[model samples]
Target: MKRFFPIVFTLLYMLAMLKPVLPVFDYVINQDYIAEYLCINKDKPEMHCDGKCYLMQMLEEQNNEKKQNLPAIDLKEYPIGFVTLINLPSETTTTTPQKNHNNYHNQYRFLTSEQHFHPPIFS
Candidate 1:
């Protein structure tokens, strides 16, 4: 179940990631077979290709397939942006508070009676 699925998924993902190396391993394991049949330079053994060309072709094909599978991005397309312009008057003015202003007081007090502190009664 739950645990088994993650393990299987991880293994599959790793195998997929290692796809490019598979051809190399195959060539290494079956060098004689590949050189005899699948190699491009098998007729001329002077190059000592030993299926290297086939392995390279396989890697290139895999890379091409990966590139083809991806979606291409459009560099010309962009999001539209909007900007707002604001206008302000050039003249500026400042005002001073009066000497007796209540805001000048450092202490504060609430004016309440005993009745105000009690909760309201329902009829």
Candidate 2:
């Protein structure tokens, strides 16, 4: 009797743990019924009366209707080969050559100097 008590207690605990798992099986079995119940609508005349289909069908129908109602566009109506001309300033010829002083020796005097023997401070 003592050994049977532990076995019965373990079985009860396992069954308690399994209660939550049972709903998943029920949901799987009733999935089709739940889907059919959600899809039904009386207001829309075009939807299937059985309501077994999903909401995607109604959306597809509306999209198709909208596409059919849109005006057709013609590519030929726009002008092709349209050229725009802009007048630019005339180029002037200079007889004298210009001197560039940007690279003069004074600009680079600090970089070329030797570093001090003491450790340099970054700040």
Pick by lDDT: which candidate is best? 1
Q: For residues 1-123, what per-residue lDDT tens digits would candidate 1 score against the true structure?
A: 889999999999999888778877888899889888999987898999888899889889888998999999875564344545568767776777657755575677887776646687899
Q: Tell me how candidate 1 scores on lDDT.
A: 0.83
lDDT of 2 at 40: 53
Residue-by-residue lDDT tens digits, candidate 2, 44-94: 647644443443454566568769989888867776658577789999987
TM-score of 2: 0.28
TM-score between candidate 1 and the true structure: 0.57
**What is model 1's C-alpha RMSD?**
17.0
RMSD for each of the candidates? 17.0, 24.3
